[model samples]
Target: MADKRTTTPAGPSTSLQRGKACLRCRKRKMRCDGVKPACQQCTKAKKGDACEYDDGKGKTRTQLMREQIARLEARVKELEKSSSSSSHGSPPANLSLSASASPTPFPLDMDSSPWDSQWNGIPDFPAVNGITDSYATEDPPIELAQMLLEIFLPHRHQVGLEVHVGRLRDSLHLPLGEQRHPVLMNSIYLWACYLSRPGSLCEHEPLYLSRALAAVNDAVPNPSKVIDFIQASCLLSMYFLSNGRLLEGSYHASAAASLAIQWGLHQLGSTDLTVGVIPCDRESTFRLNPAKDAIEQGERVLAFWQVFNLDRCWSVALRRPATIPDSKHPWTSVITPWPQRMEDYETGELEINSGSPTIQAFFVHQAQVSPVVGGFSTFAHRVKASALFEGASRLSSSWYPRLSSSPSFTENFRAFEHTITRFTTTLLPLHQLAATLPDEKTSLLLIHSLAHASMIHLHQPFLEDQGSRETAVRAARSLAVVAKHISDTDYDYLDPFIGHCWVLGSEILASEIAQLQAAWSPHPASSELRVELNTLLFSLTKVAAKFPLFGYQATKVQKLLDAI
Candidate 1:
């Protein structure tokens, strides 16, 4: 009999219909169910939001790849236009940088040629450089520039950048030829070298450094944007400090503050402070058109705090008067509110003129106050710590009247002790630091370290007293813990002020070690003390090797120990 059964049609088509897969599935070379909104695999993976599909135009994989490439190229050109072009636009919401609040170790294999490294992302263009006269140098290619800039963005805070990063990134996308002013870019490139592992990138630092200084000088006479000067000066100052160039570093730091003061950044959002004497505008003061939006206003806010931090911390480091005045004079008084993050400005959370006094409140024995009710807690705490550092530095000087322990001095000293106690023991205590978010670790580390260092400085001049010695010892132990924490990590960038603290810290520990050695019998805690001392010295040596600013002090401590 003839077979009536019909053979089943081929089980399924051998080929996939083009454009049938979700984008993520296509990238992963997985089968797609073609579900709307999300595919079954993506939904199961909980990546529904990331799942996407092209229109069913039957485009090939190569065509989709080409489209993505074209889109990326457009973004680069757009950034190039922003970097050097005259037109200013409101920047996008976020940047490509990862963990900007505190940077983690970048995964790049620094020992390899940077050319071999993959393009991580675009620059967020934080204004962060140096000098007079143009130093001609071969410019890096676009690919290399992107890589180096990507390296700089996440660590912008480490370089003291105080600009609106999104806006700055918008400004940074211009092409190399259009970059008539490369001051900020070159400065970033130089630091990219400094921050990278010892490798080919490090070799180009001088070239970038020279060009950065030249760029600064070239721009000084006719800057397209004045804020770049202030931001560039900050990085230059930090760069010099790292290289152990004290005078140059101080000069740049003062210049940054002076420029900020002249720009009226110190008095942003207010002009009504009453003074006994009338004020007159100076020719050097550069005024800007009213900010078009909140981001520009926020940049102005950050510029002031950037200078304030440099002035306060460097003054303590140098044991000299800070250049940025904090007096009651109409022209010189700093009335700007404590800085809020760029987001606060973007979200309309800040009340500009409502902030009464920042440093003024600190002078009256109150913590510095920010306009935003609860702004970046880390920044506020750091600002308070900076004030404490400045006060402690002043009191440690032999000529400071506070050294005499007069009734007024005693009162002020006790007040400082109380504030420092609260800072280290209550608000943002060190023991709880490990629980902080990853992005906040470095800043919190700096805050606790600075607080304890302030305690050491406050008690150092009176170490002759048993009470003072005990207090200083206690603070030194805390500093050791912080240093040990730092040693455990691989952070390539740190503020110059931290190095200054390490110098003082190493000195105190060295002194204690010597005293113990001189005793006929070993102290019961001798082994533990040696371990702490070794840890501090090890960290100090590591830092000094990388940053020369602390080398002289580290050498002194090592020599002192050798003699003991």
Candidate 2:
């Protein structure tokens, strides 16, 4: 067939031979069928344009990458030097005045600022040198701020401390010289320190807390700064509670509630035409438009709930009555819509309606009918559960002394029980699902644990009746199981509020075990109860290893167990 095998090309051999592969193929460690314009591998990858060969006169690809990296390193050094030089310049004198006049003034850029040094591990904070005045006008060290935020942000939503993440991040980018709310900054730092690696960051807790406390103390009297004051107060309250400083926490919690009422946040959605108008003044205008942006409005809604949550939670944690009574004047008069996820407000999915039904409306409506699906937030569920638990605590405390003499006690008790049952039925499927994201899981566990705890509190006094005692025991045992599961799987990720729930649930479990031991005749359930209590205690100790407050409480439980 025309000499069958075609004559071989004269100049170059047709047989493929390994030559210098294209740079792309060499880098990828793939064999290249060295074609002139483009290698077969590159062509097949659709990266023909990227197929480059070493010209034999230039550096290799590895050398080129090294040179480029060196250039980038040099550029970074130059920028750092420039930033260091610029930060020494005096800041604008009107910065403080502008901050005061503008409800939400944008801060100066952090680059080319003294605070930039903090990010590079340089000590830029004046407080680092023991100068306090510099702190009043400067930002906290950026490194410290970042570390604290990293520790706190993940836990914030779970604890009902949802600050506007976008706004907070924006504020952090401001130059140290720019004026910002000290209370907010300090409160954030304080909590960050409290939640940081226990021994490493704990020392900063008192310093930041003192600053936050001082700022809030001064801001609370100024009507123009009421919003800042309330926010700081809420943060501090939670900080104190997490550290087991109940009295101080309660004080700040009560103060936040007072501020909420004083600033009329509770009435933001009120449509009562009978409400009288105050004279229009600068302060009044500020109060009316404090939430000038969507972020601030979302913050206001969240702040109110934070205060409400604290009031409800601590009432049971401290064995005290809830300060905010349901259906009471200001409590029921709140006109602000129930808080939504921060993302919803940030993305404009949720619009702030001027006359939306208040959170109180949902509670009132829920009391008379079935809970509306998606009517509230996971936070609202926690608040509702806490309120129910508080009611149970109140009933138990007041009625325990004269259970038989209180003729109406049984009816009131039944009503409370019915309310709890109704509320449980309204929980979102996500809240009850076994598998969820870490944050959702923590919320779910807390809500269910609190509900079970409320049941135990409501029925423990009625333990004289066989049915009531079994119900109480069952609830307590369920709570122990839940606690054990959470500690087993989510101990490291649990919120600060979880520690409070753990304490409550563990105590009940421990009490039940103690009672079982004290029985004249060993009950068939004793061994099972003992096993559950041991598992729960083991989980609590694991949790305590992380949180000192839980550690303290866990130790107390351990002692009780030993005695039993």
Candidate 3:
């Protein structure tokens, strides 16, 4: 009693009170607590759910753990059984594979290593067999299909769309192979063809379409495999439908939906495959009538475009070096500069990643005109053009100044001039190609993009420059033609595109009139001309303000109106 005065009873062990014992230990699995969430005994013993207290109340924690362990063991057994049956039923036609084995790399590069590497977030095509149906060869399509499997799936590597197309074209010409792995083969064929179609500049060939379809038809032999395969098939078809191939694309996509239900795959890969299908009823020359598939495809594609635009712009911002002001100390930390060569140039080659083939052609042509700076500036303009269609409101006074040029205003003007010319010349033709296609939705999308591009060009600051009045006027006149296109289109089904363009058109008109008025000289009827222009600008401003995206544009115009 005399010695105990210095110390009180020790507190309960904090760890034991906090419920930190491993599940197996709690469940009386006859193993140490290990006190880990994932105990070695549970993991190594494959008793995943065997962790709880052994206190017996006929319904204690250990009893629940035992039940859970039984269930998990049952599930593991089922999966093992299914996998073993599938493997035994049909071995791979060309190359045998197991999930545990190291995969062979398929060689399928389109041009070179750079193309084979990641661009933006997309991985380069794998080194798979490059043979296509169009290639001068007579090998049975199975060989090419085998090549595709090796490139895309046998190794499960991410590949670009182009490589898939090359293998598909090869497979298409060859005779059909045995239905050993129909679902997988069907998937490959369908996706490759879908991705091969020219849509936008960013539109490179799709590498998996044909393989997916071929896998379904000849890759997986069991109709039961359809349940497993249908989701991927639908994905490839959706990719096609989204890229302006609605008619034929819808057929495969619909088939996928039916098969998904038939094979009971809806639960396993619901959104992974069928999340995009919607309900609608509209006949079109280009795309299918609005049904679950079309609706799903439309929404998904629109979402993709939105994110794609945001990413391109964000990438530009990330690439630009931090231009610290001179007000800071001269003894700044050393920072390495980005590589400047297009070959050496990262943003130096292409700033806006549209992923459209048509745009790439423009890049190639401009490269010849002025290989380094000129080409870079021209591409920079293309990126700016995207601003018109991209922002929440097309007409908003967003600064899409040339990215590759010097920060000086004079440099911006020069870049703007080159970009305008390139935009006018190429953009129109690209839209024209869309018009020729039967799909109204695709055509409208193309037209909208073209209109936005023109509008951005018209709104560049040169319109207010006295020395550039003539050039500004020319661009304005060209823009008027695009405006007429926007005005003429029936925007009933195209509220998104129309709203974007209408705001842009208003911005262009207002800016142009403001430039002309600013350049006005003291002439006899100057007051009357000014008043007339003001009225027109006011009307445009009212229209622009009504749109959500262009409300900012409208507000700016109203302020300008007040000042005038």
Supply every candidate's count of residue pairs whose N, Cα or C atoms clash at under 3 angstroms: 10, 1, 77
- Tens digits of lDDT, candidate 1, 487-544: 2332454564676776677677767766766784467665676677676677777776
Cα lDDT computed for each candidate against the true fold? 0.63, 0.59, 0.34
lDDT for model 3 comes to 0.34
Candidate 2 regions off by >4 Å? 1-134, 142-144, 174-180, 270-286, 328-332, 347-374, 400-407, 428-434, 487-489
Q: Give the TM-score of candidate 3.
A: 0.28
Distance from true location, Cα of 503 in model 2, Å: 3.2
Top-scoring candidate (TM-score): 1
Candidate 3 per-residue lDDT, tens place, 319-438, comes to 221121111221221111111212222122222212222223332344334332232322223333443233212222333456324456445444544544654554434334322211
C-alpha lDDT (0 to 100) for residue 365 of candidate 2? 46
RMSD of each: 13.9, 15.3, 26.2
What's the ranking of the predictions by lDDT, best on top? Answer: 1, 2, 3
Model 2, 1-564: lDDT tens digits are 656446744566544444367766765578776785788888886656456665454664335433543443344345435545665854322111221221111112223321122212322212222214335545555654555565566557655677766567666777543334778778877665555433334444555755775676567666655666777777877665654445666677777887676565654423332222122232443344434555666666677777777777776766556665445443335455566767566755443334434444444444334322233656657667766777677777677575776669877777777777777677654324443444556777778777877887888777777787777777767767676556343654566666655566666666766777678447677678777767667766776565544556667667777877
How much does candidate 1 score in TM-score?
0.70
- The window of 10 residues in a row where model 2 has the poorest summed lDDT is 96-105
